[model samples]
Target: MENLPKSIQVIFDKNPKLSELITNPRLISNSPFIFALSQKLNYSAKGNEDEYFYRIVFKEGSSRELMTINSGELRGLPTTTCIEKGKISDVAGLERVELDNESNLMPVLLGISLYSSIQNSLSYISNLCVDIRNHQILEGQARFERISETIVDIFNSIPDLALDKSLRDAYLSRIVKNNDDCYELYVSQREQLRHSLKGNNPDYNSKYYYENELYLFKDKLLTHPVFSVFERLVAGRICEIILSGNYSKSNIQRHKDFISKAESDINDIMASRISDLDRRISYYKRDIEMDRNLTRDGIEYHNTQIEKIELGISSIKKQIFNLLGVKLSSFDLLSQLMSKDEIDVFLIGGNLIVNDMQLTSDEML
Candidate 1:
């Protein structure tokens, strides 16, 4: 507490027991809160211009006693209350102090509660990663749901100190990176499962039955609000700089090149799929003709298969209709002149286009 703010020092003086708990070697070693605070203090001591402070408030007379933690700049007077009247009882087995209207112990209690939560979340995510690696799909999905909720709760308890570059890089960045790795692991497991099932079963219809389940699992985790926040914490600044036109000419050219390559890859994949579908349709037609003594039911099944294949081809053709040459070139040129919001709209529209192509591909499969 040597470089701690005077205001925090005053609070410590008023609450000696809380100070003792914070300085305890065991708690300090295991505490995320202490780790983050130490990082912030070290950075401030290095003569960084930004000053930070934390304020804790306890409210009485409610059905559930509430505690709030507000933190932000010591100057300019702007503060964000990360935990607003959160239920104190949410922390297990914590007894309230009657001294000084229970304010003396609230800060320590809050710290312990948040530390436990973060530890549990990190551990749970680690186990989920293991489950994913072992191909325990259902078990992994269940653990993910629990971890997702736990992470949101942990984030809500902590201050916006995560917004600080130093604090984010020290702590939250690990969680973000872990999430990215988990997603990749999930995709790899899904592919492995798909291949395993395909080899063991000849029914193509049931071969990909698990595909939607895998896709939904990935979608649910990535689209979680807390997960999105974590991603933004990791990459939002760079994205903002690029969108704000603060990037160099080379960066812009790189982006254009990336988009062009993506478009070309998509077109090539679509062309290949269309050719495969055409060959399948031709095979089914020949099967129906070559089996001259075939029953009416067999003929009907072959015709139905041909109709589905033709429909898939039609769907793909419609998607790739205006996307090949001129339209893509115009899109590349127009993106350069577009405003930030317009660029966002264009990117969103592009995702929708890609999603449509994905749907077409899934239907064909």
Candidate 2:
């Protein structure tokens, strides 16, 4: 529990298997048993304002003898406790022995407990978003328009989480897949696509739905690209004209013409570009479909590998904890090993399952 992050501890405390012990049911705020205990014993703080926890010092008259305080009461306690006894595996040769009291002990123990979880929570959320984004994107084959803001926001959060590089790559692909899906969805809505593409044209372009429509829609799609420096500059220029409060018809007309030309140029270029875009989209769809299939397969494969690797890590952690009777981080373990290239390192921890390496391969076979 000391080694686990709060978020992870919360996750586990909610677990049915571990709940009875870690999150044992107790009388909460209104219970008389709580009031009795509060009046009777000293509580070492757990350091969270909303979350309360107090340690019952095992002394002559400590109330823990009568009733053990559960996590419900323990959640709101701060880290200002004066008790001290834990070895600092977090720092090298870090050992402090004193008459254990509230003022010193809480920071050392609670700090490592708290900070570890925060970094882990960020990773957990980032991973979950990546998985959902990937799943949505992979399944999204034909649709290409009306992409939801939520999808975009989650995709954007990948980088903000400071996630490992591999997950970042996974998220980038997911974003592209979603964009492609939206594109497919847009083209499927023929009438709506047609109207949007018509763009205030008094006379509608009554081209063949499947034949010229693909090219035409492609052109229109390119016309409304979300951003470009030139278009931005044009917008800025128009804004400058407006802020000057010159509502002169001539000035307005002049700026309007410039705006019209920019729009026209974008539209014209898109029309020509759409022809190419149609081919590109078709080609991209097939290529992306293949890539999507491969990526999903790759993700599954890597996830399996990651699980295997993490299992080894867990084994390593358990070994260290068992040997030292304290949790040492990966870096700490590596540090203890120093520059040794290959360590036929002994696995020491909670339950060290020793393998009979003495058994020959032939004997095992």
Identify the runs in model 1 with alpha carbons over 4 angstroms from their true place. Answer: 1-136, 139-143, 146-163, 170-172, 203-280, 288-301, 312-365
User: What overall lDDT goes with each candidate model?
Assistant: 0.38, 0.33
lDDT of 2 by residue, 3-85 (tens): 44454446555675744433322111222222322222233243322423232234432222132233685764433222334
Q: Which 10-residue window of candidate 1 scores lowest in summed lDDT?
A: 349-358
Q: TM-score for candidate 1, please give it.
A: 0.32
Candidate 1 residue lDDT tens string, 156-204: 3333222233433344454444445444434444344344333432223
- TM-scores, each model vs. reference: 0.32, 0.19
RMSD of 1: 19.1
In model 2, where do residues sit more than 4 Å from their true spots? 1-146, 186-266, 269-365
C-alpha RMSD for every candidate: 19.1, 27.6
